[model samples]
Target: MNARPGSFGRFVADADAAGNLVVQPRMGFCAPHHMRTGLALTKAAAATTAGTLTIDSYTRVGDLAAARTALGEGAPLNGYPIAAHPAACTRALLDGVVDDTFPVQVRHGSSHPEPIIRALSAAGLDATEGGPVSYCLPYGRTPLDVSVDNWSRGCELLASLMPDGRIAHVESFGGCMLGQMCPPALLVALSLLEGLYFTQHGIRSVSLSYAQQTDTAQDEEAVRALRRLAAEFLPPDVDWHVVLYTYMGVYPASEAGARELLSASARLAVRAEAQRLIVKTAAEAHRIPTIEENVRALQTAARAASTARPAAIAPGGSKGTGDEYTQARTLIEATLELSPDTGRALRAAFARGHLDVPYCLHPDNAGRSRSFIDSTGRLRWSATGAMPVPPAPTSAGRTSVSARELLDAVHYVARRYDAAPAD
Candidate 1:
């Protein structure tokens, strides 16, 4: 159980430098043995991959008592209850599996993630991903300020693990906000901005995430924008890379369509020059995906990525990003002007309309922004609200969206993908 790659940060960086697409699964189970089984399967898969331990609903919401009870009763919770389980138990679960090369990140959807981080870090895990704003605004009614404070403390704790000379990588969940229909500009801005926030809090080895959007070209533009912005905004000493998530919107229901979409996502990751890709299974549109389904998806992604000629990923600024860069920069610059501290700036930015998420109905969210898939199959802002970004020149412009329009926009990707034959 020696730290082979030694640190998740270094391990992923190695993969990036080697041009290997580091694929990871969102797999988790209520039982510790099941979680271990998933991780083992992922590590043995014939793909460059990482492992994930997603938390159950109770643990995510701070109901460790319920999680503990479920575990005791042998009831099947939705995901692993890492917080309620003892640290030794978690370490055992990861035994012989999680090394430098096979790093596992704890995925918990908690706005106040201090306790969870404490548990995961104590369990000898060095990587986890989430953001104060990204974790809060989308999931619940948690106050923005409270989440910021809690995350600052959590970052400090996770950073403390580096005293043993291993880097604890923290990835930003900001780019994957609301899963779908959020404009890539906002997603890119939030991802980079959150990475900056992590840097300020002393976690230097970080990753910024961008989920696949409606259009392939647009998604490529967004990832390039994120990389360009990272070079410009992130601290020089910090080690960072881009992670792409498969489209988090309403997935294609048909198995053929789902595989096509997943394959496209894998190709997109390579073409965008992302170091890591969070994959989606063919079972995504239905119930929870089994471990076999996850393994198949991982292998499929590896095959797609192996054949890909990754696009050139230099920091080309405007040439790399276009309008996505301009709008995202507007949002980031506006927020930074509010305060030097990343957390405080985020709070102030959202309080005003300086930063907004489209189609996000969270109370703290300004609710003014809305986006829709346009005529060219690109996700475009229908209304920018009070955001600093200019109005999009697309057909889905400043008009209001009715309930029917919103429903159609939500299903836009599913229809688009299903209409075409699987490659």
Candidate 2:
């Protein structure tokens, strides 16, 4: 597909017109310093000549406005863009503060589609019917059975709501599993299957969001594995992207450290020919990142990508780490196989039309859970515990919650309370 006219182009042109080197993609404008850096990077990387590269920037809602300002004022494009947040928390983002946001939407057996739909409306973004902005549907740490059913139902609901095709992308989150590793084959197959499912359901883009250890050679190998999967499974017609979000709390605490990690990540991405790169801010694992901190982090990552030397693609190793590559391949393969079973369960749950009320470990469950369910139906409270069950079926028949609603419920539960024993 032809590239869409992105905010970056306008930023570049604006910078050039204004005689500034800096160009911010968010506002489609540029300044002089930005231009010089771009030129310098272009010239410096001429030897490696990987061809034209594109980078999109992403951040959280609290940082969106500032990120937009930095981008418009001229933040570098060596990284990919993707703002991450729990599905229910991004109402502010869709309110139009950031360019985009990816909210996790976990599916239990039930559906709660209103928040997403309402958020889209509140943001003045259209639905699939009205050219809605791209939103992420994240399957959080829900059990495989619930996750698949939730995702499938979510897709069906989205398709139904967006006959005109509003969704632009769909992504999944990786959680700690079996040593926090998914088998390689499973990863590959799931990637393709997800792409197919989204494509079939009318979503035009698909991506995966997972955290990685920046300190290990294994991380680099995992990137290579992803590249191979992209090459083999990604349909030529599909707009596919992969995001290797760093676990900021793990390594690279200082500016210099962050730069080194970013440089390494950029090289890996370039070698892999990844469509986009998402460089996590240093504050990620520790706490929520402030806007200024995030911008600084992106700046550091951009510099690394722009200035780093392209490492030779080792015969089989990435950065001389053979084990990394081997492990990555193995893990991805294993994960891909499990995806179908996961998908099947998710589809079945959606078919059953049960609501997955979210319960979390956090203290904010009251506001969060209420936001997910509709105004008319009350949350069915279990006599034994705090777990809120779905209200009884209404006169219109058992009131069915959308997939989005189920996810919201899951998010609420996960954030505020531990999962209750499954009924």
C-alpha root-mean-square deviation, each candidate: 2.7, 17.0
TM-score of each: 0.96, 0.46
Q: lDDT per model, in order?
A: 0.87, 0.35
Please write out the lDDT profile of model 1 over residues 1-423, one tens digit for every residue. Answer: 111246776777788778789999998898888899999999999999999999989988888899999889988899989988999999999999988679899998898787788899889888899989999999998888888998898898888865577777889999999999898999999999899999888886899999998899999998888888988888777888889998898999988888888889999988888889999998888889999999999999999898887676467534455888888998999999999998999999999988988777788889898777777888877777788776667543356667898899889888877888756
Name the regions of candidate 2 deviating beyond 4 angstroms. 1-114, 121-143, 159-167, 175-197, 214-217, 248-263, 284-286, 309-342, 345-423
Give residue 211's lDDT in candidate 1 (0 to 100): 96
The sequence of per-residue lDDT tens digits that candidate 2 reaches over residues 1-423 is 221222222222233234222211111112323322332333232122111111123231123455456656666532222222233333332332223221122111112333343333333332211110011222123333433444455555554554342443444332111112222222333344455555555555455433343233444454555545555555665554454444322443444444455545555544433334445454543554443444455555455545533346647654423443343344334434444443442233222322111232222112122212223322222211221222333444433446675555434312221232221
Error of 2 at 100 (Å): 11
What TM-score would you give candidate 1 relative to the actual structure? Answer: 0.96
Clash count for each candidate, listed in order shown:
1, 73
Minimal lDDT window, size 10, model 1: 1-10
